[model samples]
Target: MNRRHFLQLLATLGVAGCWGSYKAYATTSSAKARVLIIGGGAAGLSMAARLNSVLETPDITLIDPSNEQFYQPGFTMIAGGIYSPDEVKKPQSACIPSGVKWVKEKVVSIDPVTSKVKASDGNTYVYDFLVLTPGLQMNFDQVEGISRSTLGVGNAHCMYDYQGAQNTWKALQEFSQKGGAGVFTNTFTKLKCGGAPKKITMLTDDYCRRNKTRDKISVTYYNASKDLFDTPYYAGRLEEIFKERDLNICPQHRLTGVDTASKKV
Candidate 1:
């Protein structure tokens, strides 16, 4: 079943866990299973929660260095000025489900042969079951002439991180107020969300239109692939939207080099 349908069924059945699923435990031996989870992101937290709810006696340890856990999907909303920074920000302690131990540290290295992981604090963790849900990494250094130092300096902005999204919102507001050419492009690297840039671009255009400055400013979108979307059905609709909105679309224009001095990508 689809996720929506599954969730509806869960709600209907009144399942006991957060998403509507109950737990069943039988009294037997005092045996317990050791579960070691890497990364405290969404996937890892979900796995930990589910296992904690189901397992009779589970020793679950979740490892991550960050104290603040962010809801990254809401970043686009922040960039679009639909949400504030506080809305997407949350304490990591709030997401840890029942019976899961939180280790506030980074993992230095992992040894699969010995089923052990070394933490930054010079401690080793040995596990019986390992779940690795480390999220994807952003390679800001991959772009030429642009380092972490130059972000949010000028009209240029990025929504990949929390501060970047807030800065992007400000930059977009400034650009929307002042008439100028607004250019946005995507990278060829595997990103967390492929449509995030496009969504922000469309939102910016809409914002400009609402402010009555859209006619003075030009918006252009550059994509790494030739197609707007992988599926033909959605691609055709997106192309139609581009035509209707008079938005410029440049296909197969991946970002290779950047002139950070001029704020050109």
Candidate 2:
């Protein structure tokens, strides 16, 4: 849905991100309304907490199946061995806000027309209002010849998931020891973090340099976009740095396939 429609829907229930305004009005205006939130990630919890804090008596229920909450941005750091995997993990229970009903379940499908949500438990929940923040999914299968099973094999590696990042670390250590060409590529899609590809590339480059394998290791960056960064100033500086470091950058080229058998992309 568009931003205007999304805002109008929430505004119908007098829901606003601002705690002070919501507290001043929503409690008196919409306290009795039943609110069900899908997903227990940062956005979902923050929304639930704000509602719980502001409502005189919140009727809020949050549904999420995850046993643990992850600090996703730290995946790159984990891949580089800069931070341990445990540092990014926390029990989902600990992060959930107080005064809210928590249901450890996944949503099978949502029937917006019927104001119903069907979950993994085979139950339908009806709500006066609903919020969804389940987060993003990576579609590795969309790339020709690439599958989830292909990761951490040969030169194939990614740092998007916790296990994938840890595995990438292992592959990186071995690759660095016997220096060769390493390819770092970005997909042409709305990825979780825009800076993630660049971070992974630079981190790998740093590791090679520190290990005195810079001359032996050739790092090539394949950027789907023409510019390194969307912002002009930063993009200019990044380009300069890449040139100084003698890094090869192939812009406007997206990775469409993975040839795992031949170890090519």
Candidate 3:
């Protein structure tokens, strides 16, 4: 059965109780197992699903802060105006298997030796096995002259967040309307979903073309790396696209600061 139908049947029969008993037996037997998974993102959820499908019954607890789960790959499409935010977002409850315990809270600290984790809500979770899939945190504040609060507000926009993706769409639309040179920069640091920056840039270019502002607006992409993409094959293709569109690509150029008032980078 599909996931939705399985969830409906589980809910109708209150199968969560049966799973609780299974969890107890697994934890108590000589072969008992208790798995605690952290982050509940792509990796964590996929692991849980695989384990659940193989085992007759599984003891799994997944910890995540947000009830809303996002397909991060879709963020690139969202920035490109190819998909809506809602299309990329799914309720965490839907992805979580019924048999697994889902904790909605942030992990504050981890005691690896004891195999215990402490959450922001003061709950202590212990397990026989621990799987950590917490993703890297972005430090936008590290960008000089850019404050954490200024993101998605003023001349700054990043697709790291859903709102940030919408902000980028808005910024591109406004720039198209005003008609000016727009500089899009990606830092030297390894960013999640590396194609995201160029995706936005291309989308902006497409928008300008559609609005008949292509000549008035100049698009430049600056990156510390020498290539458009990490992979040679993809970089070659991207270079061709950039050349065809007359989009300027500046390699080995890193963004130091943004002068929002002067509208220069």
Candidate 4:
């Protein structure tokens, strides 16, 4: 639906508290509305909390299958050995607002026409207003010879997943000790954090440098875009730093597949 139409619908349902203006209003009354949130990630939980606080009697139902809410930004830190996996995880039940209802089920399909959603448990949910905060999903299978189950195999690791971040840490440690060509690349499709590929790349570089193995390793970063970064303010300086460090950067190179057995991408 269009933004205007959606806003009008929310007003019709008595949920006029927009996120932008929610902070300005005090909760002296309750809103008679049913808000159905379809995710339990940061966005979903945060929205649920805001609604619960602004509305005294918030009939909010959040549908998600995950048992834990993860601090996804910390995943990169975990890969760099700066944070542990447990540090970035919290129970989903604890994160949800006290009054909000939590439905621990994945959404199978959503029928906007009927204002109903079908869950994996074979139940349909009717809602007055819907908030979709479903987070990104990684498609490792799109890359040949590399699936979610085979992460860390042949030193192929991605920091996006919890276990994958830990595995990347392990691989980084091994790489630091036995220096070799370390390749880091960005995916062709949109990703959660654009700077993550650069973060892990530079982290690995610095890791080897601190370990006194900098000379033994050759690091190369492959960028799907022609520019290393899009921000004009920092791109020039970042390029200079990469050049100073003798880091090989190949632009417009999108990773299509990988050969885990041969450690090739």
Error of 1 at 212 (Å): 0.8
Overall local distance difference test of candidate 3: 0.78
The model with the greater lDDT, 3 or 4, is 4
Listed per candidate, the RMSD to the true structure in angstroms reads 6.2, 4.0, 8.9, 3.6
lDDT of 4 by residue, 1-265 (tens): 3556546534533455544443453533344677899998988887777667766567889999999888988989999999988999999888988989999999999999998999999999998779999988899999898999988888888999888899999999998888899999988797999988888988888888888999989999999998888897777788888888888999999888899999899
Best by lDDT: 4
Better of 1 and 4 by lDDT: 4
Q: Which ten residues in a row have the lowest lDDT in candidate 3?
A: 22-31
Would you list the C-alpha lDDT of every candidate in the order shown?
0.80, 0.83, 0.78, 0.84
Q: Which stretches of candidate 1 lie over 4 Å from their true place?
A: 1-32
**Model 1 clash pairs?**
15-20, 15-21, 16-21, 16-22
Give TM-scores for every candidate, taking all chains together and pairing residue i with residue i: 0.87, 0.88, 0.84, 0.89
lDDT of 2 by residue, 163-229 (tens): 9999988888888898888888888998988888888888888888899888888889999999998
Task: Give the true-structure RMSD of model 3.
Answer: 8.9
User: Candidate 3 clashing pairs?
Assistant: none
lDDT of 3 by residue, 1-265 (tens): 3445434333333332344333332321112367788989897887677556534557889999888889988886787778898999999999997788899999999998887999999999998767788987888878776765687544778887788887777777788889887788887887787888888889889978988988888988997799989999999999999889989999999888776666566
Ordered list by TM-score, greatest first? 4, 2, 1, 3
lDDT of 1: 0.80
Q: After aligning candidate 1 to the native by TM-score, how far in Å is the CA of 31 from where it should be? A: 8.4
Q: Report residue 178 deviation for candidate 3 (angstroms).
A: 1.4
Distance (Å) between predicted and true CA of 105, model 3? 1.5
